[model samples]
Target: MELSELTIHKAHELLKQKKISSLELTMALLERIDACDEKIGAYISIAGEKAIDQAKIADEAIAKGNISPLTGIPVSIKDLICTKGIRTTCASKMLENFVPFYDAFVIKKLKKENAVILGKVNMDEFAMGSSTENSSIKITHNPWDLSRIPGGSSGGSAASVAADLCLASLGSDTGGSIRQPASHCGVVGIKPTYGRVSRFGLIAFASSLDQIGPLTKDVTDSAIMMNAVSGYDRNDSTSVSVDVPDYTSFCKKGLNGLRVGIPKEFHSYKGLDPEVDLAVKNAVKTLEDLGALSVEISLPHTEYTVAAYYVIAPAEASSNLARYDGVKYGFRDMDKKTLIEMYKGTRSQGFGDEVKRRIILGTYVLSAGYYDAYYRKASQVRALITEDFKKAFKKCDVILSPVAPTPAFTIGEKADDPLTMYLSDIFTLSANLAGIPGMSLPCGFSKSGLPIGLQIMGMHFNEEKIFKTAFNFEQATEFHNKKPMR
Candidate 1:
């Protein structure tokens, strides 16, 4: 079975009726991973036996009629997320051998739902870099075009779903990690409102901006996957205390009265491919045809998002990574002669260049003379970015924008230049800073035949509205049906 063709809802029905067992579903994914993962390099480590054990338990529960929408679905987890007994490397040598005794809040949620854990997918080291090239182990190639990159740091998760190695996967989006990769892979990915989903088990990138979200094959599946994991958790201090709603209940409410805001700033971004721009434009036309309204708007503070995020995110990363010293946990070089040697050797050997670079920059900004100048000021700018979204939401139900300036670039195109690679995250940084929900679904293909994504951003805790709108758009277009030549 092509796992990508199976919707989360359909899998649930099949499981409840005993037409399929969770063990069989898990085996199917394991078989798919065995067949295609070598070509895609999606999974850093596939949990063959452990996943089957979980599936057997799921089958038992379903046979007893204790069912959920995700009861029998097999899903992959990004390596950044701790999976207890499973090796939870954030694609960094630092934690390559470390395994958490506890599960992340999201992981616990999935276990309760009886979802099969496919394995740990690869990602950038310490969640740095826009491409998975920063991974300490191996590079994750794009399933869309093997020579090009699958966007990171969620590249492995996106590639797995795109190549049908798993039904869906969880990814963290601090900047464009989730959306960018989803666009590159031609799948559905959503970065929920910060705090909407708990971040307890996720390896820190930017604590304030980071979120765990689902990457699946369609809007409906995205909603179903989201439902299984979203909600407040006491473990994560930043988790919001909002009421969780029946997200799937509203998935079919067509976009009849939806008001979508299209920011004018998106059209004039430098180096935006003409084909991608045209594709987004056509998407607006399709929305109108489906009885939705699109109106031009301006996020006047859009330009500051990138500048502010770099400073703010790094400041947090500098602090978060401090725990990786040899004395604490993770990587430790045993042959060190002195205390300083031990600390230096462990970090130098554990973290990749991009991760080290971010730690240095972050530390520098938060250091004595620079804190007030860079870190503090960037926080102020972050406020304005969030305010821009708050104000925009007052005028529209959802904001529609391009996921990235262009389609998937070649594997080594931006890998050499850190700044050039960071620029590709231009369109997505704002949503993270704003701490709102954002999603990227396939809008159309580029002239060169690569995929382009249309980002749907919503106000605080308004994922239902975003889902209703995206579902309507998905039903009206065939863009999501265009599979990559895997």
Candidate 2:
């Protein structure tokens, strides 16, 4: 196997055994990115020299017997996470030249573990779209089928991992950004329970719904990445004071005594692709055969997920993104003389169409005349959605569903229709809305050979359960082992 394709655990084993040095592994990945990233368009910035320097330091640490699972691993980062001295664009022209003075909480954790960061990958501009074509920077193509979208907001993160450009990546999930893309790209992506991982440095789209997580080649790697980054943070008010468990320990647990919930509403949803439906049903049967109890459950409010999410997410985004006027650190229109003109001109020129559309919708919803009619009602629906998940969890240990309604569609297929694009995240928005842990991993493939993802969600702070379930299924199937042809 190519060194660039090695999982974090495997690479750590080789590094600790002196079979390979961090420099060699890092270089192998850099070479892979150099050779393949052009066609994939997975990266917005490449930090080759910095990664080499970090790898050298990691090798020295390994020699001193200070190695961890990620000590010598190479990984990619979503561009929205702030990295000190590295340009953090958020895939928007607004912050194209912006560099952070400090690292995000997750980046600090990764650095402490001596992980080498290859570069910042692309995303939907301000995380406002379902397809990466919304990126003002570049269009990240699916490695499985170059003509199709990899999926969005975290498209580049998933694409890089699937294409072996990087072993794993860090991505933020707000309304299914992480899992949908992971499904489209055929990789493992986890969104820990809200406040499980610190969001201190993440560029916020919807502060209440955003959670930082990992995208990896397999389930074990996902656990390793989660272990390094999950913990209470004094810097973030929303971060809960909870003990972080050893996620890796749960990976070996079999499916015996596990209860998996299948939501009736999801299976009966209109427009679900037959291929995806078959794959998920087969996955449920496979779980049953492995001694897991499959129970039909109801999250009756599931039908309202898409409508509720759009209103709540955009409302939060409107308030959070208001800081990007001309006076801040990002782009400013100096050509305008009046202050208001500068503010208007900067935002008009800086943000992309999707971003502007969301901002306008958000602002309108939050206005005095409409707040009671839109944002307030959405908040009520959000509470109901959370209640729905709470009720469903009482009946099962974990919930299983398709990550997306269909396999990845070709780029531009739904770009002109924002409502259709929002529906792409129907299966995933509930987890984020309820602030619970969720994951996406390969279950099967579409008839056209595109990948299909199976989602496993657990109660808040119960990532161990999700990991145990995902690992068992991954062991039984070869879906995750299949790589995209470059």
lDDT of 1 by residue, 1-486 (tens): 454457677787788788888887788789878977898999998899989999999998998989988887899999989888999989988988888898999999999988889899989987887778889889888887899889888999999998888889999999989999999889999999989999999989889889999999899889888888998899999998988898878778467778999998878888688888898899889888888889888899887878899998888998999888978668899999999999899989888889888899999999999999998899998888888888888889999989988888888888779987887788899999988899999999977788899999998899998898888888888988777775
Clashing pairs in 1: none
Any idea what lDDT model 2 has? 0.93
List candidate 2 stretches off by more than 4 Å: none
Tens digits of per-residue lDDT for model 2, 359-403: 999998999899998888988998998998899999999999999
Model 2 earns a TM-score of 0.99
Q: Per-model C-alpha lDDT, please? A: 0.88, 0.93
Highest-scoring model, lDDT: 2
In angstroms, the error of model 2 at 140 is 0.6
Clashes per candidate, residues 3 or more apart or on different chains: 0, 0
